[model samples]
Each structure stands twice: as C-alpha cells, then as structure tokens.
Target: MTGGAVRPEGPRASERAARPDGALMIEARSISYAYKETVALRDVSFGLPKGETLAVVGPSGCGKTTLLSLIAGLMPSTAGQLRVDGAPVQPRRPGTALILQDYGLLPWKTVRENVALGLRIRGMKPDAADQALREVGIADLAGRWPHQLSGGQKQRVAIARSLALGPDLLLMDEPFSALDALTREEMQDLLLSIWRRHRTSLVLVTHSITEAVYLGQQIMVLSPRPGQVVGLFRNPTVGDRRAAAFHEMVNRVRDALEKGVNGGA
Candidate 1:
C-alpha cells in the first residue's frame, strides 16, 4: 500500500499531532454490559486518543458491536464508566456517528434523500449533502434509489450520510463485511483517506485480522462472550498492509484472539 507516491498526512493530522499525547477523546473504565440475563461485556476498558483509530477484533459474539454501541451512546453500559471528551456518553451525543454492516439505508429513499436525512437534523444546506456524496465518490448516483445500487454503492451512501453530519467520532460495526473482497479493500482505503483528511476519531469492530492491522492505530483483541480485553497492540505504521510489520502485527493479534477465546487472557 505504501508503494504509491508518498502523500502528506494532511493538515488536520499534523495539527492534531501537536496536542498532548495524553489527551484522550474517549476513555472506558471497567465497562460492563448485559441484556436481561446475558452479559455481553465485562471489565472492558481502553483509552482512544484524539484523532487516532482503534480496531476491536475477536471471534463472533465477543461484544465488539456492543462496545461500539456504548461509545455511540445507543445503549448504556450496565457497569463502569464510558466518557467522551471527559463527559458521560449520552444518546444523540454531539459529533458522533455509527455505521452498521447492513448499510442501514431506506429502500424507499433516493441516494440523495438518504444522505440528506441525517443532515436535516442540523438544518444543513443541501450543498452539504451534495458535498458528502462527492466525498465518497458517489455524487453521480445521487438520484438513484438504494435498491438501484450495488452493495458497495449502498455502503457508500451510508458513509455519506454519516459524513454529512461532520462527526468527530465515527463508530463502525463490520461496515465492510458484506462486500466482495475487492470492494471491501476499496472501501477500506477510502475510509482511511477520509479519516486522514478529517482526523476523526474512529473505532471499528471487525473479525478480519488483516483488516484490523491495516487500519487500526491501536488494535484491541477481546475474549469470548462476556468479552474482556485480552490485549492491545499498537500499529503506528499500519497504513500499508503490504508492509512486513503489518503482517507480523496481524499474526500477533490472531494469537491474542486465540488465547483470549481459550481463556488465556
């Protein structure tokens, strides 16, 4: 991935790099969650610094999506504390967006309408939605309905909708799992480009080790159901999946997941 011409990290990343390293955008302390009789997570904790990315990877039902929901304030953690910008996370928290694997688009709405839907909450001008579509390279398809688009295009609409809101924190739960391998790779690259340009804080929940190592600044592995933090690996140079270190990091995360599932964490 690094073979291409070297590019700048963009002004936002450069500007954000000047902030104190200890300045965190989100902090989870011993967070635990449950649904009636089922516990999904336990004593899960991590700190995500401003403008950095974290990828949560584990086996099925490891509370990866649950963690994203807690951060997005979709549901409250049954125990412990989850804070965004030093305050308790709340529903509809300002500057937060969550993208799901299903694309979450309304079949009845046109591409432009779907993208414009979220922006309507802020009374943003139509041009803002148009810009978002362009950002995702889907501007030409604005008039088409969701059913008229391919899986990748539909996902692009979901991304455009979130970007239209100009979120500072972006949470994604297997957002690319449904796409074909080639499309998934394209979307991954597009996502990283957007992240660098906007410097938004990102947390992705995925099952793919290669995907985790490719995009995560901090890769966290979780144990089985009633998920617990097994290990956290830093991958500062993970921008290029082709790099030797990227593969090495993927192997490390894979081992951690295996150990975690077997109660070795």
Candidate 2:
C-alpha cells in the first residue's frame, strides 16, 4: 500500500462493455487472405449480434466479397479464424445461408420447387415446402420456372428458399445491386420485412452507401485491398426510413465513405 494509484480502464474497456450479450452470431477475427502474394484482408475483425443486420461496404477489390466467401465457408481464410454462433465455421453449415446477386436459382426447377430445395434437402414435408413459398409471397408463381419470372421475382424466390431453411444467419452479396432503383428499394423493404418476421441475423456486403444505411443497424467501412475496418457507424434511429433522422444518418455514412475513398482512411 505504498503509493501505487489504481488507473481506470480507458476507451477500449468502454467499447468492450458496450458489446451485446450472448455469443456473437458471426465473428471474423484477424481474418486475412491472399491470392498468391496479393493480400485480400488484413487483420479485419467484426462481429454480428443476434437479430442485427451488419453491412460491409468498401471500394472494389477491397475484400468485401472475399469476406462473404469466407463467412459462407466457400473458401478458407489464409489466416485468422471465423466463427458462426460460437462454433468454428466449416466448409458448409446448415445454420448459415448465402444469397448472391444473380439469384442462383435453378432454371429447371419451378418456383415452389426452387424455394423448397433447402427444405427438401432437410426432409421437410411437401406441404411445408409449399408454405415457405407462400411466406415469401411467391405462392402464386409456384408453377412458374425461373426463366418465366422477372428479375425481382427471381430474387424473391431465392430469398424465399433461403428463409424456408430457417438459417440462423443470412449472408447476402450485393443481392440487389443489379436491380433498378425502384426494384432495389422494393427488395430492401421486402428483405427487412422478412427479417423482422424471422429475426435472423444478416450480413450484407455492398458498394452502395445508401443501401447499407437503409438496411444495416451498423455499417462497417473497409479500406482498399487488404481490407480493414476503416470506420464504424451505428444508426440508433431504427426503421422510419422516411424520417429526416434516417436521411441524416444516411448522409453521414455517405460522407464517411467519400472521405475514406479520398483520404484512403
């Protein structure tokens, strides 16, 4: 008890205190990868809380897609670790799913069949599979084939298929990036509605700042190649997309992204 003075923990301690309870739904810690000598990710770390939507945004070749691939277990990271709900992610896990921009629907399968594929694999009853199609608002199109549907319809089917499986986490890679502005907005709304009902955690990788702001409770901005989290923004004003507060948050994210691009932050 001489003269030693105890010091309080600082900002990092406060940051840790703010984390959510329960195991993270998904975690990427010190995740790094390389294609030969070209680095893809460098010490990138982030976590998704249960029922939260975390959006990842960055410039081209910034490892956003690579991160998604790693999370989906399509490819292993060259270094670091990835976990899905406290367990190490494997090459494939029934608890997670991915939706790509192209929809990835099987052309030969009818809408209902396509949406039911996951359930079918899991041995769900045929009627239950039909119910999943209805849940996604595509029941009427159940008999239609992929080629017979519009782009938005096809994407909905893809989403329906993913939801039917009731996965704990959904990974989407620019799923709406190719749609027209109106369709994109519609798809975003549909996605949020489904997520609200299902309460599944989502991790979406996109290049659009507005999309990220519209969909994510928290947005993570990554630096160029060998991507790292350059910025993080949390939008406390959930929903009410038309509200001025929502627009303000969107602008904030947009400005931060612009600055990151210009300053290489």
Query: What residue pairs clash in candidate 2, if any at all?
Result: none
lDDT of 2 by residue, 35-112 (tens): 999999888777677767788888999999999899988988888888888888887798899998899999999998
Off by over 4 Å in 2: 1-20
Q: In lDDT terms, how accurate is model 2?
A: 0.78
Clashes of 1: 0
Q: Quantify how close model 1 is to the true structure by its C-alpha RMSD in Å.
A: 5.4
Write down the lDDT of every candidate, Cα atoms only: 0.84, 0.78
lDDT tens readout by residue for model 1, 106-154: 8898999999998776777766789999999999999998889999999
Q: Residue 207's C-alpha lDDT in candidate 2?
A: 89
Q: Indicate the TM-score of model 2.
A: 0.88
List residue ranges in candidate 1 displaced over 4 A.
1-20
Q: After superposition, how far is residue 152 of candidate 1 from its true place, in Å?
A: 0.9
